[model samples]
Target: MLYIGVDLGTSSVKLLLMDESGDIKSIVTREYPLYFPQPGWSEQNPEDWFSALTDGIKELTKDCDKTTVDGISFSGQMHGMVILDEEDKVIRPAILWNDGRTQAECDYLNNEIGRDKISAYTGNMALTGFTAPKLLWVKKHEPENFAKIKKVMLPKDYAAYCLSGVHCTDVSDASGMLLLDVKNKCWSKEMLDIIGLKEEQLAKVYESYEVVGTLKKDIAKELGLPESVKVIAGGGDQAVAAVGTGTVGEGMCNVSLGTSGVVFIASKEYAEVDQNALHVFAHADGKYHFMGVMLSAAASNKWWQDEIIGTKEYKKEEAAITKLGDNNVYFLPYLMGERTPHNNPNARGTFIGMTMDTTRADMTQAMLEGVAFALRDSFEITKKLGVNIDRIRINGGGAKSPLWCKIIADVLNVKVDKINSAEGPAFGAAILAAVGCGKYASVEEAAGKLIKVIETTEQDPVIVAKYNKKYDIFKDLYPTLKTMFDRIAE
Candidate 1:
């Protein structure tokens, strides 16, 4: 049998087709426009996602046997606010995960309500990107829209509803909403009351690999697929990406350097809040994982190469940056504010320690090293919890850069393994569909058979020592500039 995985991303929708044995048959992508009506705010129409998925599926399965398709699943951008009326029409353009319009609501949750209580109820602290804060933003500013809301769903869950005629979400995806009791794997009534929502407005929660419903007959007919095809409850992009990298069993680690950078570490049993800095969320493999995120990763490189240097030749520019950690110039990678360690919305990107002697190569190296140091901040918190990780499987666009991968390896002092297939969340979603369809017995089993490492980048002790001294200095710049960032923003 065949399975389909839909990766609903911020910029595009990517679809993948796979056989029962985990071999990919074909992959397709459809791009969509992103709207920015104001500074620091991002929005997208959810209807575009459904249309792209339907069209991409048709293109992906055109030459293949569509009748053999057995199941479908999704890995989606998390924390977007998607609402529906009584007739299930989209109420407004979705507030994207990167939207920073929720600073007031976040301050209300973290300071007025208190982070301790919010963490106690939701198992995570409030950020500007979480669904709870987005909900508050809508209620305070768009009162008319809030009054008409009949249901609130995440981005990919909206597409699943259109395909399967079910309103549901998985625990891994719900963990980012700030409305779930993540430690307990259920919705928190306290959070619901705080957001002025009842249980009826929320979708039913399910495990990531469970079957949600069969595909709607109309949808199947339009795509030339079987009506009996099952739609499984999948996960958020990060969780599913972990599965694709084979980071499923206890103590496994996966590092992703996409638009955002993340470090994922799996645990055999549920762990309570530790440090409360890193996210403690349920994993798609029916266990638990701790994750740390950097708001800008590969995006830092993109901004420098395209917007600043005026070039699309990333490889040519990076080829000039030979020096790793000895550059005098330094860049604080806060282009999108920051998340993991800082959690400061007022923070802005900065360049410190530049001189007349500094070259473009020196500044470029700083951009790469800056992102590495930020990720190391999160790794320190995980170490405080007594979690030890020796090596991590790396994925995403940044992972394709040899210099960046080497910098991450030496800075973190962990070996970085490059996988043969780095298709991101779309491939991961397809693997989840295969598991749900009983093509494989368990998630671990599926990953063990599918995820393959093609090469490993080992950390050099000499380079590691150089970055270690530089990281200590990088950690101090944020606190010193915190007030300045706020004052300038005001």
Candidate 2:
């Protein structure tokens, strides 16, 4: 049997085809434009995503026997607000998870609404990236558009709706919306009331690996597949990626350094993890997970390499860096503001301690280390929750960099394992599809059979000690510049 995994990403929709045994058959990607209507505001037309998803599916399954495709599922960018009218027409461009234009609404939720009360209701602090704040922003600033919201879904759920004709979302993705009462696995009525939204506007929730609906006849015929093809409820990218990496059981961990970075620790219960709370999200495995997110990870390097350096020779540029944990320069990877520890939307990317003697390699190394240190900030929080993590399964675009992987190993003082496939989210989506199709007994079994660690980057004791001190300085920089970041935004 074959399954399809559609990863609806920020810049592209990546589709993967795999067998029941987890062998990848084919892969295809379709790119789409991202819009920045204003600085710090990010948006994408849901129509563009739907087009990419459908077109990519056709290309992805062209060589295979379409009848054998048992299921299709998704792993998508979470927390994006995709609102639709009564007729299901998109009301506006989706407010992407990386967008920082909802600071005012986040402030209102965290302060006027009271953090303690909001946390009690949703198990998360209101962050600018969350869907609720984006909704509040729209309601306050664009009331006309807000009034048209008849159903709301995350990025992937939109594609699910297009395929299966079901207005539905999975627990993992909805947890990021700041509207789900995560512990209870339901929408928080308090949050709905706060946003002045009715329950009918939201999608029906499901577990990530559950079968939500079958393919619509029209969509199935268009994609050269059967209407009997099951539409599985795949998950938010991070949770599903954890499944792909075998991070399903309690205390198992996966760190993703994709467009965004996440330090994800899978848990079985919904209890509070720490004083920081550390982003308590519903896991794709029908449980819970604690996550710490950075808005920019490989994206920061992509900007430096593509937009600024004018080259895609990332490895060639990385080859220039001979120093590890020894750079004088420091970069704050806040190109899209921050989320994890310092929920600061006003934060801007900064390069400090640069001198005339600073080489491109030094600055490059700083960018890499800066992201590692930021992830380490989350690792610290997980440790505070008494979660013992000695090794982590690492996957993402940044995981392809040997230097960056080694830096992550030393910075976190743990073994970083690289799996066979770098397509974490897409692969995980396939696993969810497999589980939904009864190809595997459970997600854990599917992951265990499929994911193989190809290599491990062992931590260097000397570099680890060096980074321990460097991280101390790195953590302080954000706090020191908080007031300045706020002032500059004004």
Candidate 3:
């Protein structure tokens, strides 16, 4: 049997085909244009995502027998607000998760509504990216559009609805919306009233591996597949990636250094919100997980290489850097503000302690180490919650760098394990589809059979001690510059 995984990303739609044995048979991607009407706002057309998926799937399955495809699932960008009218037409281009225009709405929730109440109710505080804030933004600014909202959905759930004729979302994805009472695994009535939305506007929530519905007859015919092809309710990108990396059960960890960075840790029991820093959400593995996000991870390095250094050869630039923890330069990796510990949109990137004697390699190493230290900030928070994680599975573009991997290992003082497949969320969604199709009994069983740790990077005690000192300095820079960042953004 074959399964299809759709990674609905910010810049493109990536489609992957995986067989029952976890081999990637074929993969294809299609890019779509993103619109920025203002400096801080981000928007995209839902039609573009649909078009990309249909075309990419056609190309991906051209050589294979499409009738053999057993299931389809998705791993998508979370917290984006997608609304449909009474006629099921898109009310407007989706307000993307990364959009920062909901500051006023966020203030209303965090201050007036109060963070303590929100945390107690939704297991998270109001952030500018969350769906609850976006809804409030529309109600205040675009009241006309607010009244026209007959149904509300996330980016991937919209695609699932189009394919299966079902309005549904998995628990993991719904947790990010601030509408679900995460601990009890149901919608929070208080949040619904606060957002001025009814329970009917929400989609039916299911476990990540549960089958929502089968493919619609017309969609199956168009793709030359059987209508019996089940559509599984997959999960948010980070949650699915954890399952793919076998970061299931208690104390298991997965660190993703993708376009955005995340530290995902699974726990056997429900953990409450702490300082509104780490996200408390439902895991795709039928458990609970805590996540900390940094808006810029690999994108920081990409910016330094392409926009600053004018080079596409990242390996070549990093190859010259041999120094690990002795660099004099320090980089604050806040190119896109920050998320985890400090939810400051006004924060800016800075290179501190740079001198004339600083070499190119020193600056490069600082950039890598700066990201590692920032990740450690979140790791510190997870420790405060009494969740002790000693090892983590690593994925994403930055995970390919040996030096960066070593930096992360020493800085966070945790074992870093590299898995065979680096497909992240898309591959994870495919595995969930396999589980839903009965190819595997549970998510943990599927991962145990499929995920292989090819290598492990252990922390060096001496270097870890050096980084421990460096991290204290790294942590202090953000608060010290908070006033300056706020003034400059004005």
lDDT of 2: 0.91
- Tell me the deviation in Å of residue 328 in model 3: 3.9
- The most accurate candidate by TM-score is 3
lDDT string for model 3 (1-490, tens) is 9999889999999999999999999999999999999999999999899889888888989999887899999899999999999888999999998898998888888899999999999999988888999999999899999999989999999999888989999999999998999999999999999999999888999999999999899987887778999999999988998887899889999999888899999987898756888999999999999999888899899988889879998889889987677887899999978888898878899899988899888888898898998899889988988999889999988998888899999999999999998888889999999999999999999999999999999999999998888888999999999999999999
Model 1's C-alpha root-mean-square deviation from the true structure amounts to 2.4
lDDT, model 2, position 257: 83
Runs with alpha carbons beyond 4 Å of true place in candidate 3: 305-323, 354-357
User: If both were scored by TM-score, which would come out higher, candidate 1 or candidate 3?
Assistant: 3
Task: After the best TM-score superposition of candidate 3, give how far the Cα of residue 221 lies from its true spot, in angstroms.
Answer: 1.6
Per-model TM-score, in order, reads: 0.92, 0.89, 0.94
lDDT of 2 by residue, 291-371 (tens): 988889999999988998789899999999998978879999999888788766679999999999999888889999999
Candidate 3, residue 300: lDDT: 91
Q: List the residue pairs that clash in candidate 3.
A: none
Off by over 4 Å in 1: 37-40, 272-275, 306-329, 354-360
The reply for model 2, stretches above 4 Å from the true place, is: 36-40, 142-145, 273-277, 299-336, 348-367, 480-490
